[model samples]
Target: MAEAAGCPLSVIVPALDEAAGIAATLEPLQVWRERGAEVLVVDGGSGDGTPEAAAPGADRVLGGARGRAPQMNAGAAAAGGRVLLFLHADTRPPEDGDRALLTALEGGRHWGRFDVRLTGASRLTLLGLVGAMMNLRSRLTGIATGDQALFVTRAAFRAVGGFPEQPLMEDIALSRLLKKHCGRPACLRERALTSSRRWEDRGILRTIGLMWALRLRYWLGADPAVLAARYHRG
Candidate 1:
């Protein structure tokens, strides 16, 4: 993989049992691959042929430890790029997102994330509000979530020791560490489209409440293992 400036970029997608949407998720990224970006799909022991489904679109399809943090770390370890972008299985990057990320780095930011728009069966109005609130919160707190498509330079990532190996809140943890090492994120205006199934499955308001509660507990020193179980149960 090679960029015009000799700075290679790698997009890492960590998935588990995502065979149903893996192809769609990787499709748009092919354009980036054409531009010398290496696209890697790290699967967490999916029994549904996710690896095979992902192999055609990705530069490398890797088997990794279960959980987003570990799987993403595995991808980072195997990536050959000077810059890394962590994308979720259900998220779609904006047009020219690869260039956007690289441009942000070129402008001297060490790490950044795109704003996100939720897409699914939910009403557009409510979803729009949720997406706006999320973007606003991230900008205010200088924290980027995985759904926002977080990107970082190799040096910054190494300085922060990568994402913490936790079951939940790994993105939040990584953001906090990155902020300390590299300052606030770029917080790009471009939006990545993330699935709204999380909110749609459980009423939108309920999902919001649950997420806030989980964060509050985590901040108060709750065990990530327990939070993970509660999140899954919901």
Candidate 2:
């Protein structure tokens, strides 16, 4: 891991049709912004006012191609921070997340992700199990998903050539690259609270099964475009 003593941190969010949650998502990050960190929102051709809604909380809101990979890459390109944290519109990092990331980096980690907590209005007992399983799986596999709030130093990110511009599994793809080049990530115990709307709306067990199937297919060298289409259809 490269030394990142004085480089500022940047929180990069990729959004699309996220008007309802954009403000809430960026709100907590305002404290970090005030402390010299920058927050950038890259909108992926949102029909709703996601970009406008994000402007108040973000240092800059820019338009980009309609995909998480592209939008996030755009944000990274424009970001001024030496360390970049990629956050989803429906996720919120734990309090003092900036310090946590910086501390991890200073301890010699090039890239890492937080443990995730899935939350929703529904009373789903299995949600706890799901989150636990996710954390454990990431620890074992050295593969972190987008929901976990992935962060990496600028040098490491550029070395991996950023997230692969794939239709699906871009997070997984980037994780593999990073693990190959920079070694295993620092698995922070502090959780990033991620929305469980997908699981709740799509049925928790069904979503789990689908995810496993998708992952298996992806590992089997299936086309990401087809997998993405299948994911959206579900």
Candidate 3:
């Protein structure tokens, strides 16, 4: 499907202290540019030279407030495209993922995410299991996280008031809002590769348990700030 509107698509990446991973995250976009998409990287108080490393391939780089949500919103504000793709600094889309995203956007799926894969082979089985679970959940409930490389039309994003400027779970919050406004979400066939650093650090099962517990608490109407604090403390 091709967009009836002729405006370009913009891929926005929000980064923080991602010097080690930013280049890998951006390499796919360099190929996307050849297919006529714009790429923007928004840095949030990165002490490392992430901005510089990402600048060479990015169409524009903006420095912004130190939070992923705000940084993404800033990038969206600066974007000239009608379709906005919000990617994490540690995630990489597939080679033809931009085209696939455009197709989804044009097919009237205003907001959606790709399937996810964890990079590297260490503990690959465990990470793959988690990815399978997430895929199943997304297929059943249309809920996806940012690490899966979510995309939406600019109008849909603005209609949902953009991403909430929170310290944590901004992606989940935004996904909920999008589902409320858009009715149903969609998923691309291609998978986005995300770093397994967090799982590696916290242990996959332990982290998954903590995440489920936090989700249960949130569903029980726990305060976002409290949950964010707990996440930070962990």
lDDT of 1 by residue, 123-217 (tens): 35888889998999999999999999999998899888999999999999999999998899999999899999989889899999999999999
Candidate 2 vs. true structure, TM-score: 0.95
10 residues in a row with least lDDT, candidate 2: 1-10
RMSD of each: 2.2, 2.6, 3.0
- Candidate 3 lDDT over 80-171, as tens digits, reads 78788899988889889878888877787888889888876333487888887887788788877888888888889989999999777888
Against the true structure, candidate 3 has what lDDT?
A: 0.84
Best by lDDT: 2
| Count of backbone collisions in candidate 2 | 0
Q: Which consecutive 10 residues in model 3 have the weakest lDDT in total?
A: 1-10
Q: Which has the higher lDDT value, candidate number 1 or candidate number 2?
A: 2
TM-score of 3: 0.93
TM per candidate: 0.95, 0.95, 0.93
Error of 2 at 114 (Å): 0.3
* Model 1, runs deviating above 4 Å: 1-7, 121-124
The candidate, 1 or 3, that scores higher on TM-score is: 1
